[model samples]
Target: MLLRMPGVYRPQGDTRLLCAAFHDANLPPGGTVLDIGTGTGAVALTAARAGAASVTAVDIARRAVVTARANAWLSGLNVEVRQGDALTIAAGRRFDIVLANPPYVPSVVDVDARGPARAWEGGCDGRAVLDRLCAAARDLLTPGGTLLMVHSALCGTEESLIALRGLGLKAAVVSRAREPFGPVMRGRADALVRAGLLEPGDIDEELVVIRADRAITDH
Candidate 1:
Protein backbone atom coordinates (compact mmCIF):
# COMPACT_ATOMS: atom_id res chain seq x y z
CA MET A 1 0.00 0.00 0.00
CA LEU A 2 2.78 2.44 0.85
CA LEU A 3 4.51 1.53 -2.39
CA ARG A 4 1.43 2.48 -4.43
CA MET A 5 0.55 5.73 -2.65
CA PRO A 6 3.79 7.69 -2.38
CA GLY A 7 2.27 11.17 -2.43
CA VAL A 8 -0.37 10.97 0.30
CA TYR A 9 0.85 11.26 3.90
CA ARG A 10 -0.13 8.45 6.26
CA PRO A 11 0.95 8.91 9.85
CA GLN A 12 0.17 5.35 10.87
CA GLY A 13 2.69 4.31 8.21
CA ASP A 14 5.24 6.10 10.31
CA THR A 15 7.78 3.70 11.74
CA ARG A 16 7.06 4.77 15.28
CA LEU A 17 3.34 3.98 15.27
CA LEU A 18 3.72 0.85 13.16
CA CYS A 19 6.46 -0.49 15.35
CA ALA A 20 4.63 0.37 18.54
CA ALA A 21 1.23 -0.90 17.43
CA PHE A 22 2.67 -4.17 16.16
CA HIS A 23 5.80 -4.82 18.21
CA ASP A 24 5.83 -2.62 21.28
CA ALA A 25 2.38 -2.08 22.68
CA ASN A 26 0.07 -4.72 24.12
CA LEU A 27 -2.75 -4.60 21.56
CA PRO A 28 -5.07 -7.47 22.42
CA PRO A 29 -5.18 -10.02 19.68
CA GLY A 30 -8.16 -9.34 17.43
CA GLY A 31 -9.18 -6.13 19.18
CA THR A 32 -11.13 -3.44 17.37
CA VAL A 33 -9.42 -0.33 15.97
CA LEU A 34 -10.40 2.94 14.37
CA ASP A 35 -8.32 4.98 11.94
CA ILE A 36 -9.37 8.61 11.69
CA GLY A 37 -8.42 10.34 8.45
CA THR A 38 -7.61 6.94 7.09
CA GLY A 39 -5.78 8.12 3.98
CA THR A 40 -5.31 5.22 1.65
CA GLY A 41 -6.46 3.11 4.60
CA ALA A 42 -2.87 2.24 5.35
CA VAL A 43 -3.17 2.33 9.13
CA ALA A 44 -6.51 0.61 9.35
CA LEU A 45 -5.44 -2.11 6.96
CA THR A 46 -2.22 -2.52 8.83
CA ALA A 47 -4.18 -2.89 12.05
CA ALA A 48 -6.39 -5.53 10.42
CA ARG A 49 -3.30 -7.34 9.23
CA ALA A 50 -2.01 -7.21 12.78
CA GLY A 51 -5.07 -9.10 14.04
CA ALA A 52 -7.50 -6.33 14.80
CA ALA A 53 -10.98 -7.91 14.88
CA SER A 54 -12.63 -4.88 13.31
CA VAL A 55 -11.29 -1.74 11.64
CA THR A 56 -13.23 1.32 10.57
CA ALA A 57 -11.47 3.91 8.43
CA VAL A 58 -13.04 7.36 8.36
CA ASP A 59 -12.11 10.40 6.29
CA ILE A 60 -13.69 13.74 5.48
CA ALA A 61 -12.88 13.68 1.76
CA ARG A 62 -14.93 11.59 -0.62
CA ARG A 63 -11.82 10.93 -2.69
CA ALA A 64 -10.00 9.68 0.37
CA VAL A 65 -12.87 7.38 1.24
CA VAL A 66 -12.92 5.97 -2.29
CA THR A 67 -9.17 5.53 -2.41
CA ALA A 68 -9.08 3.93 1.02
CA ARG A 69 -11.89 1.49 0.16
CA ALA A 70 -10.17 0.52 -3.08
CA ASN A 71 -6.91 -0.06 -1.27
CA ALA A 72 -8.65 -2.14 1.39
CA TRP A 73 -10.26 -4.33 -1.25
CA LEU A 74 -7.03 -4.74 -3.17
CA SER A 75 -5.24 -5.70 0.02
CA GLY A 76 -8.04 -8.13 0.83
CA LEU A 77 -8.45 -6.59 4.25
CA ASN A 78 -11.90 -6.16 5.78
CA VAL A 79 -11.83 -2.42 6.47
CA GLU A 80 -14.90 -0.19 6.47
CA VAL A 81 -14.08 3.22 5.01
CA ARG A 82 -16.60 6.04 5.40
CA GLN A 83 -16.77 9.67 4.34
CA GLY A 84 -17.56 11.99 7.25
CA ASP A 85 -16.09 14.95 9.04
CA ALA A 86 -14.59 13.96 12.39
CA LEU A 87 -16.15 16.96 14.12
CA THR A 88 -19.78 16.39 13.10
CA ILE A 89 -19.89 12.61 13.00
CA ALA A 90 -22.47 10.80 15.14
CA ALA A 91 -21.51 9.90 18.68
CA GLY A 92 -21.98 6.77 20.90
CA ARG A 93 -19.53 4.84 18.75
CA ARG A 94 -16.35 3.82 20.55
CA PHE A 95 -13.24 1.82 19.77
CA ASP A 96 -10.42 0.07 21.59
CA ILE A 97 -7.89 2.18 19.72
CA VAL A 98 -8.16 5.30 17.56
CA LEU A 99 -5.45 6.50 15.22
CA ALA A 100 -5.38 9.94 13.63
CA ASN A 101 -2.86 11.64 11.36
CA PRO A 102 -4.77 14.84 10.98
CA PRO A 103 -3.69 17.95 9.02
CA TYR A 104 -1.39 19.93 11.30
CA VAL A 105 -0.30 22.73 9.00
CA PRO A 106 -1.08 26.16 10.47
CA SER A 107 -2.00 28.70 7.84
CA VAL A 108 -4.20 31.70 7.21
CA VAL A 109 -5.83 30.40 4.05
CA ASP A 110 -9.59 30.18 4.31
CA VAL A 111 -10.58 26.54 4.61
CA ASP A 112 -13.20 26.98 1.86
CA ALA A 113 -10.50 27.96 -0.60
CA ARG A 114 -9.20 24.41 -0.73
CA GLY A 115 -12.67 22.81 -0.74
CA PRO A 116 -12.56 19.21 0.52
CA ALA A 117 -8.78 19.20 0.71
CA ARG A 118 -9.03 21.63 3.60
CA ALA A 119 -9.50 18.63 5.88
CA TRP A 120 -5.71 18.50 5.99
CA GLU A 121 -5.17 22.15 6.85
CA GLY A 122 -4.49 23.00 10.52
CA GLY A 123 -5.36 26.69 10.20
CA CYS A 124 -3.07 29.48 11.46
CA ASP A 125 -0.68 28.08 14.10
CA GLY A 126 -1.70 24.61 12.91
CA ARG A 127 -3.75 23.49 15.93
CA ALA A 128 -7.25 24.19 14.66
CA VAL A 129 -7.96 20.68 13.49
CA LEU A 130 -6.03 19.08 16.33
CA ASP A 131 -8.01 21.00 18.90
CA ARG A 132 -11.31 19.89 17.45
CA LEU A 133 -10.19 16.27 17.13
CA CYS A 134 -8.96 16.04 20.71
CA ALA A 135 -12.24 17.34 22.02
CA ALA A 136 -14.26 14.85 20.05
CA ALA A 137 -11.89 11.96 20.73
CA ARG A 138 -12.73 11.93 24.42
CA ASP A 139 -16.19 10.52 23.74
CA LEU A 140 -15.16 8.11 21.00
CA LEU A 141 -12.62 6.08 22.93
CA THR A 142 -13.47 3.09 25.08
CA PRO A 143 -12.14 2.86 28.59
CA GLY A 144 -8.41 2.17 28.54
CA GLY A 145 -8.42 2.81 24.81
CA THR A 146 -5.52 4.55 23.08
CA LEU A 147 -5.57 7.64 20.86
CA LEU A 148 -2.56 8.18 18.66
CA MET A 149 -2.17 11.45 16.76
CA VAL A 150 0.60 12.90 14.59
CA HIS A 151 1.09 16.67 14.78
CA SER A 152 3.69 19.36 14.05
CA ALA A 153 6.23 20.32 16.70
CA LEU A 154 6.00 23.97 15.74
CA CYS A 155 2.54 24.02 17.24
CA GLY A 156 4.17 23.76 20.67
CA THR A 157 4.18 20.55 22.64
CA GLU A 158 2.96 22.32 25.74
CA GLU A 159 0.00 23.68 23.83
CA SER A 160 -0.95 20.21 22.67
CA LEU A 161 -0.63 18.86 26.19
CA ILE A 162 -2.90 21.60 27.40
CA ALA A 163 -5.47 20.86 24.76
CA LEU A 164 -5.44 17.17 25.53
CA ARG A 165 -5.73 17.90 29.20
CA GLY A 166 -8.82 19.93 28.48
CA LEU A 167 -10.29 16.83 26.83
CA GLY A 168 -9.18 14.54 29.66
CA LEU A 169 -6.52 12.95 27.52
CA LYS A 170 -2.78 12.62 28.03
CA ALA A 171 -0.39 13.56 25.21
CA ALA A 172 3.28 12.88 24.57
CA VAL A 173 5.67 13.17 21.66
CA VAL A 174 6.00 9.76 20.06
CA SER A 175 8.23 10.68 17.12
CA ARG A 176 10.02 13.60 15.52
CA ALA A 177 10.77 14.21 11.84
CA ARG A 178 12.38 17.26 10.34
CA GLU A 179 9.97 17.34 7.44
CA PRO A 180 9.78 20.08 4.84
CA PHE A 181 6.47 21.90 4.49
CA GLY A 182 4.60 20.81 1.40
CA PRO A 183 4.05 23.15 -1.56
CA VAL A 184 0.56 24.14 -0.48
CA MET A 185 1.75 24.82 3.05
CA ARG A 186 4.74 26.81 1.85
CA GLY A 187 2.55 29.07 -0.22
CA ARG A 188 0.02 29.39 2.59
CA ALA A 189 2.72 30.37 5.06
CA ASP A 190 4.09 33.03 2.76
CA ALA A 191 0.67 34.49 2.20
CA LEU A 192 -0.12 34.36 5.89
CA VAL A 193 3.12 36.14 6.71
CA ARG A 194 2.31 38.84 4.17
CA ALA A 195 -1.10 39.18 5.73
CA GLY A 196 0.48 39.49 9.20
CA LEU A 197 -1.06 36.28 10.46
CA LEU A 198 2.42 34.82 10.90
CA GLU A 199 5.95 36.10 11.23
CA PRO A 200 8.46 35.51 8.44
CA GLY A 201 10.82 33.64 10.74
CA ASP A 202 8.07 31.32 11.91
CA ILE A 203 8.06 29.47 8.63
CA ASP A 204 10.37 26.47 8.49
CA GLU A 205 10.59 22.71 8.76
CA GLU A 206 9.13 21.31 11.99
CA LEU A 207 9.25 18.22 14.18
CA VAL A 208 6.02 16.27 13.67
CA VAL A 209 4.22 13.54 15.64
CA ILE A 210 2.37 13.43 18.89
CA ARG A 211 0.91 10.13 20.11
CA ALA A 212 -1.60 10.51 22.89
CA ASP A 213 -3.89 8.34 25.00
CA ARG A 214 -7.07 8.69 27.01
CA ALA A 215 -6.87 7.54 30.60
CA ILE A 216 -9.17 4.85 31.94
CA THR A 217 -10.28 5.12 35.54
CA ASP A 218 -12.06 2.24 37.14
CA HIS A 219 -15.08 2.86 39.33
Candidate 2:
Protein backbone atom coordinates (compact mmCIF):
# COMPACT_ATOMS: atom_id res chain seq x y z
CA MET A 1 0.00 0.00 0.00
CA LEU A 2 1.23 3.45 -0.86
CA LEU A 3 1.19 6.11 1.85
CA ARG A 4 -0.50 9.22 0.49
CA MET A 5 -0.29 12.58 2.18
CA PRO A 6 -3.43 14.67 1.91
CA GLY A 7 -3.33 16.82 -1.28
CA VAL A 8 -0.95 14.51 -3.08
CA TYR A 9 -2.51 12.95 -6.16
CA ARG A 10 -3.56 9.39 -5.46
CA PRO A 11 -2.82 6.71 -7.97
CA GLN A 12 -5.87 6.25 -10.13
CA GLY A 13 -6.78 4.99 -13.57
CA ASP A 14 -4.24 7.18 -15.29
CA THR A 15 -1.54 5.87 -13.01
CA ARG A 16 -2.58 2.31 -13.58
CA LEU A 17 -2.65 2.80 -17.33
CA LEU A 18 0.76 4.40 -17.38
CA CYS A 19 2.20 1.57 -15.31
CA ALA A 20 0.70 -0.98 -17.64
CA ALA A 21 2.21 0.72 -20.64
CA PHE A 22 5.58 0.91 -18.94
CA HIS A 23 5.50 -2.81 -18.36
CA ASP A 24 4.91 -3.45 -22.02
CA ALA A 25 7.39 -0.92 -23.35
CA ASN A 26 10.31 -3.44 -23.46
CA LEU A 27 12.82 -0.67 -22.84
CA PRO A 28 16.48 -1.39 -22.45
CA PRO A 29 17.39 -2.79 -19.08
CA GLY A 30 19.43 -0.89 -16.51
CA GLY A 31 18.55 2.44 -18.07
CA THR A 32 18.32 5.74 -16.26
CA VAL A 33 14.71 6.87 -15.71
CA LEU A 34 13.03 10.13 -14.90
CA ASP A 35 9.47 10.49 -13.62
CA ILE A 36 7.99 13.98 -13.89
CA GLY A 37 5.01 15.01 -11.76
CA THR A 38 5.45 11.93 -9.66
CA GLY A 39 2.76 11.70 -7.01
CA THR A 40 3.44 8.89 -4.54
CA GLY A 41 6.42 7.72 -6.57
CA ALA A 42 4.30 4.85 -7.75
CA VAL A 43 5.64 5.06 -11.31
CA ALA A 44 9.11 5.87 -10.06
CA LEU A 45 9.08 2.84 -7.80
CA THR A 46 8.10 0.72 -10.75
CA ALA A 47 11.20 1.84 -12.57
CA ALA A 48 13.41 1.26 -9.58
CA ARG A 49 12.03 -2.24 -9.10
CA ALA A 50 12.42 -2.90 -12.80
CA GLY A 51 16.21 -2.65 -12.46
CA ALA A 52 16.70 0.87 -13.72
CA ALA A 53 20.23 1.98 -12.89
CA SER A 54 18.81 5.19 -11.51
CA VAL A 55 15.31 6.56 -10.97
CA THR A 56 14.65 10.22 -10.28
CA ALA A 57 11.23 11.72 -9.60
CA VAL A 58 10.30 15.40 -9.64
CA ASP A 59 7.16 17.17 -8.44
CA ILE A 60 6.23 20.77 -7.83
CA ALA A 61 4.59 20.03 -4.49
CA ARG A 62 6.62 19.57 -1.35
CA ARG A 63 3.99 17.21 0.01
CA ALA A 64 4.37 15.09 -3.07
CA VAL A 65 8.12 14.94 -2.65
CA VAL A 66 7.69 13.85 0.94
CA THR A 67 5.00 11.34 0.08
CA ALA A 68 7.02 9.85 -2.74
CA ARG A 69 10.14 9.62 -0.63
CA ALA A 70 8.12 7.92 2.10
CA ASN A 71 6.67 5.46 -0.38
CA ALA A 72 10.08 4.66 -1.77
CA TRP A 73 11.42 4.04 1.72
CA LEU A 74 8.45 1.89 2.66
CA SER A 75 8.80 -0.15 -0.51
CA GLY A 76 12.57 -0.46 -0.14
CA LEU A 77 12.95 1.12 -3.55
CA ASN A 78 15.59 3.59 -4.60
CA VAL A 79 13.99 6.75 -5.92
CA GLU A 80 15.41 10.23 -5.72
CA VAL A 81 12.42 12.49 -5.08
CA ARG A 82 12.91 16.21 -5.65
CA GLN A 83 10.53 19.09 -5.22
CA GLY A 84 10.65 21.55 -8.11
CA ASP A 85 9.39 22.29 -11.59
CA ALA A 86 9.98 19.35 -13.90
CA LEU A 87 11.85 21.28 -16.55
CA THR A 88 14.01 23.07 -14.03
CA ILE A 89 15.05 19.84 -12.34
CA ALA A 90 15.69 18.18 -15.71
CA ALA A 91 18.00 20.85 -17.06
CA GLY A 92 21.27 19.45 -18.47
CA ARG A 93 20.20 15.90 -17.61
CA ARG A 94 19.27 13.14 -19.97
CA PHE A 95 17.60 9.87 -19.09
CA ASP A 96 17.18 6.70 -21.06
CA ILE A 97 13.48 6.70 -20.20
CA VAL A 98 11.20 9.57 -19.32
CA LEU A 99 7.71 9.09 -17.88
CA ALA A 100 5.08 11.78 -17.39
CA ASN A 101 1.45 12.07 -16.28
CA PRO A 102 1.09 15.79 -16.04
CA PRO A 103 -1.98 17.90 -15.21
CA TYR A 104 -4.32 17.68 -18.17
CA VAL A 105 -7.77 18.45 -16.89
CA PRO A 106 -8.98 21.59 -18.61
CA SER A 107 -10.21 24.17 -16.16
CA VAL A 108 -11.91 27.54 -16.41
CA VAL A 109 -9.05 29.14 -14.58
CA ASP A 110 -5.40 28.20 -14.64
CA VAL A 111 -5.91 26.31 -11.43
CA ASP A 112 -8.84 25.92 -9.08
CA ALA A 113 -7.44 26.78 -5.70
CA ARG A 114 -3.65 26.19 -5.39
CA GLY A 115 -3.52 23.20 -3.07
CA PRO A 116 -4.70 19.80 -4.25
CA ALA A 117 -6.38 21.07 -7.38
CA ARG A 118 -2.98 22.00 -8.78
CA ALA A 119 -2.48 18.29 -9.21
CA TRP A 120 -5.16 18.07 -11.90
CA GLU A 121 -6.29 21.49 -13.05
CA GLY A 122 -4.80 22.30 -16.40
CA GLY A 123 -5.14 25.77 -17.80
CA CYS A 124 -8.02 26.82 -20.05
CA ASP A 125 -6.88 24.61 -22.93
CA GLY A 126 -5.47 21.80 -20.76
CA ARG A 127 -2.16 22.10 -22.57
CA ALA A 128 -0.42 24.31 -20.09
CA VAL A 129 1.67 21.61 -18.48
CA LEU A 130 1.36 19.01 -21.21
CA ASP A 131 2.70 21.36 -23.83
CA ARG A 132 5.74 22.16 -21.79
CA LEU A 133 6.47 18.51 -21.14
CA CYS A 134 6.07 17.57 -24.79
CA ALA A 135 8.32 20.42 -25.76
CA ALA A 136 11.03 19.14 -23.43
CA ALA A 137 10.71 15.43 -24.19
CA ARG A 138 13.43 15.33 -26.79
CA ASP A 139 15.90 17.17 -24.62
CA LEU A 140 15.12 15.03 -21.59
CA LEU A 141 15.90 11.79 -23.35
CA THR A 142 19.14 10.36 -24.68
CA PRO A 143 19.37 9.43 -28.31
CA GLY A 144 17.09 6.42 -29.01
CA GLY A 145 15.55 6.89 -25.57
CA THR A 146 11.81 6.70 -25.08
CA LEU A 147 9.24 8.94 -23.41
CA LEU A 148 5.96 7.53 -22.16
CA MET A 149 3.22 9.96 -21.15
CA VAL A 150 -0.45 9.73 -20.33
CA HIS A 151 -3.09 12.43 -20.67
CA SER A 152 -6.78 12.84 -21.24
CA ALA A 153 -7.91 12.96 -24.86
CA LEU A 154 -9.55 16.26 -24.02
CA CYS A 155 -6.04 17.63 -24.06
CA GLY A 156 -5.59 16.93 -27.78
CA THR A 157 -3.40 13.91 -28.47
CA GLU A 158 -2.55 15.18 -31.94
CA GLU A 159 -1.11 18.37 -30.54
CA SER A 160 1.21 16.45 -28.24
CA LEU A 161 2.35 14.23 -31.09
CA ILE A 162 3.02 17.21 -33.31
CA ALA A 163 5.03 18.92 -30.61
CA LEU A 164 7.23 15.88 -29.98
CA ARG A 165 7.63 15.13 -33.69
CA GLY A 166 8.55 18.72 -34.47
CA LEU A 167 11.30 18.31 -31.92
CA GLY A 168 12.61 15.38 -34.02
CA LEU A 169 11.22 12.51 -31.95
CA LYS A 170 9.10 9.71 -33.39
CA ALA A 171 5.78 9.92 -31.59
CA ALA A 172 2.64 7.81 -31.55
CA VAL A 173 -0.27 6.87 -29.35
CA VAL A 174 0.49 3.46 -27.88
CA SER A 175 -2.59 2.89 -25.77
CA ARG A 176 -6.10 4.26 -25.31
CA ALA A 177 -8.81 3.59 -22.72
CA ARG A 178 -12.25 4.98 -21.94
CA GLU A 179 -12.83 6.04 -18.34
CA PRO A 180 -15.89 7.44 -16.65
CA PHE A 181 -15.73 11.05 -15.57
CA GLY A 182 -14.27 11.47 -12.13
CA PRO A 183 -15.65 13.79 -9.48
CA VAL A 184 -13.73 16.76 -10.86
CA MET A 185 -14.59 16.09 -14.45
CA ARG A 186 -18.19 15.31 -13.53
CA GLY A 187 -18.50 18.57 -11.66
CA ARG A 188 -17.00 20.48 -14.57
CA ALA A 189 -19.19 18.75 -17.14
CA ASP A 190 -21.48 21.68 -17.59
CA ALA A 191 -18.71 24.22 -17.97
CA LEU A 192 -16.80 21.88 -20.23
CA VAL A 193 -19.87 21.45 -22.40
CA ARG A 194 -20.26 25.19 -22.62
CA ALA A 195 -16.60 25.39 -23.54
CA GLY A 196 -17.23 22.77 -26.25
CA LEU A 197 -14.74 20.40 -24.66
CA LEU A 198 -17.48 17.94 -23.95
CA GLU A 199 -20.82 17.01 -25.47
CA PRO A 200 -24.10 17.37 -23.61
CA GLY A 201 -24.40 13.67 -22.82
CA ASP A 202 -20.78 12.70 -22.83
CA ILE A 203 -20.10 11.05 -19.49
CA ASP A 204 -16.81 9.41 -20.29
CA GLU A 205 -13.39 10.62 -21.35
CA GLU A 206 -10.62 8.80 -23.15
CA LEU A 207 -7.14 8.45 -21.70
CA VAL A 208 -4.25 8.04 -24.08
CA VAL A 209 -0.68 6.84 -23.59
CA ILE A 210 1.71 8.47 -26.01
CA ARG A 211 5.20 7.13 -26.60
CA ALA A 212 7.87 9.21 -28.28
CA ASP A 213 11.31 7.92 -29.19
CA ARG A 214 14.35 9.98 -30.05
CA ALA A 215 15.97 8.81 -33.25
CA ILE A 216 19.23 6.98 -32.76
CA THR A 217 20.71 9.03 -35.57
CA ASP A 218 19.90 12.32 -33.83
CA HIS A 219 22.73 13.95 -31.94
- Residue 177: error of model 1 in Å? 1.3
Which residue pairs clash within candidate 1?
106-126, 107-123
lDDT to native, each model? 0.68, 0.91
- TM-scores of the candidates in the order shown: 0.80, 0.97
Task: Report the alpha-carbon TM-score of model 2 versus the true structure.
Answer: 0.97
Residue ranges of candidate 1 with Cα displaced over 4 Å: 2-23, 110-112, 189-204
- Candidate 2's error at 144, in angstroms? 0.8
TM-score, cand. 1 vs. native:
0.80
Cα shift from native, residue 116, model 1 (Å): 5.4
Per-candidate count of clashing residue pairs (backbone under 3 Å) = 2, 0
